[model samples]
Target: MGGQISVRGVTHVYTNRYTRETVLALEDISFEVEQGEFVCIIGPSGCGKSTLLYLIAGLMRPSMGEILVDGRPVTGPGPDRGMVFQEFAILPWRTVWRNISHGLEIQGVPKEKRDEIVRHYIRLIGLEGFENKYPYELSGGMKQRVALARTLACNPKVVLMDEPFAALDVQTRITLRTELLKISLQLSNTILFVTHSVDEAALLGDRVIVLTRRPGRVKEIVRNPIPRAARDEHTMENPAFIEYRNHLFYSVRSEVQVAEHEALVRG
Candidate 1:
């Protein structure tokens, strides 16, 4: 079953290692992600979208407030939460099957069971034939599919993605988006996806969380009106999708402008 996430008044601060200069990244940010919910977070560059994910992943501690996964406070990285990064962080030496089975191996699952799980995910990601292929031999999209399959094989309660599709080309990105949506629906995964594209957010998210400029705060949390089953290529042409996309684009653009101005001032 998917886990519910509760982020209560969370704030994060970063300090330059050498200069010891502190900067506020996220401020008083609070939100909730229900079990099996697909939540996408969008914000201006450096507005701490990735930072927020790290906080929830327990990779870093929030300066203030708390992040809870299924009612338990996040203290450090755990198997209950899985993260997929922009970079395809799969092992180059491992074949697609091996990469997908890595997590299950870590859990000490028997080879027979691990093989079964890995094969299932390979089919899930449409990489059945490429199971023997190494990372370098695969396309960018295929590698990401391997990475995602690896994460999903662990059966994490919540899946966190940090621009997982941002590195792909346009066509590949679109293709993977649909594949991911299908897989998510099939698995009923609880996902927290962070992206810079408003259209992507509109297409993939049950709710979109927009953040303000530096010292990022929750600007708004917009619920997607389009039903998940109805979200497809044709859905982009629908008026409701356009309206949601435009609303998010404008909201994010405003924050981007503010961030640029602040950068100029700092310069």
Candidate 2:
């Protein structure tokens, strides 16, 4: 397993010069993603969920606190931290194999070694047969597999996902969400996933971290200590699963409702 992630009171503030206003996107946010744990953050849209991902990925600096990986602060993006976004984020011009190994290619990995890693991840993501295809020829899910394989090829300590399946249709999202858990286990890597779906969060998370609306803050963290059996949709129909899902839904549902009302009131 890879190293863990420690976010210590990380605050992100956005400033707009035109209005001379400052927006606190995240305030006093602190959480720990243990090694090999699948933790998901969910909240209303524009609530700084993506902002938090940026902080952990070293894409942006937090205004008030620090984000660290295994006790070391993340000053910049590194191989230890790999990300897969909502968009496919693949190079359309490159072949599937080339896109998967783009990171290694950039890192000066030799063609032989890069090809092997590409093949490994292609198999890992079950895209072995499509190695030579272009992303344009693939479905949304297949494109995402290419993206996931690309990130996995880097062999990061943690995989940070930002609503990676949100763009897909309901069925595809559900399928991928389930597959993601399988992928997480097969890789045994730590993951911090951000999403808007309570069902999705509860379905995949080892721990679900709920955040508040704008100026996002951790509201409640629910531990899904019960592991779900793989490939069994029956778990979702189980009373225990229903209770867990409802509990999470009711927990965050009101906050989301309030945020919506507030938005309409402002408009």
Candidate 3:
């Protein structure tokens, strides 16, 4: 079964080693993601968007409350969840094929099976001919394709993306987003994506979770009415698309102003 996530009154606190001061990164954040749903999270800078993603990936524990996957509490990292970061995390020295097979290698999968799975994803992500190229030899978009193939090859129940497309150029980003939509539908993948772009969130998410300023709280969860099969580059011109875009833009704008005010006061 694909993963379903539940967050119950979760709060995260961070302490500065030098200052010995505690700051609340997220306060009483709670939400639920149904299995196979594509959920996008957006918030102002430092509103703990990435922190929340990390928390879900089991990279860290919440200071209070709990997170659960498929009714089981999250304790630490496991194969059930895979993470893709804004910075492509592929090994610099490894060729595309080897990088995609790294996770299977760590899990002690036999070389024959690993090769089979890696070859499948290499074709799935459109990196067929570039299998022997190192990270330094590929473009940013190709490197990210390697990162994604590696994650999907592990067969994780949930895919955690931390602004994976933010670093790509506008054209490349759009192309990949469309490709991702197709892949997720084909695989019925469950995903939780963190991004700053309202338009991107509106285009990609089944539901967009808006967050408040620092000490991030769930402000609202906007359900995207656009069907997955219907989304494409031209969908931006559709009235429904424009409405969703406008709504998210306004919702996040208020939080952006609040975050700016807080910055000025701190300064």
Best TM-score among the predictions, by candidate number: 1
lDDT of 1 by residue, 146-174 (tens): 99999999999999999999999999999
- Give lDDT: candidate 3, residue 137: 96
Model 3 TM-score (2 dp): 0.96
| Global local distance difference test of model 3 | 0.92
Q: Estimate each model's TM-score.
A: 0.97, 0.94, 0.96
TM-score of 1: 0.97
The window of 10 residues in a row where model 2 has the poorest summed lDDT is: 225-234
Write candidate 2's Cα lDDT for 1-267 as tens digits.
Answer: 556989999999999979979998999999888898889998878889999998899998899998889989999988899999999999999989989989998889899988888888888778877878998899999998888888888888989999899889999888888787777777767888999899888888888998988889999999874684442445678687788889889878878899889889999
| Per-residue C-alpha lDDT of model 3 across residues 104-172, encoded as one tens digit per residue | 999999999999999999988999999999999999999999999999999899999999999999999
Q: Give candidate 3's error at residue 110 in angstroms.
A: 2.1
Comparing candidate 1 with candidate 2, which one achieves the higher lDDT? 1
Can you give the lDDT of residue 234 in candidate 1?
A: 81
Candidate 2 TM-score versus the reference: 0.94
| Candidate 3 residue runs with Cα over 4 Å from true position | 262-267
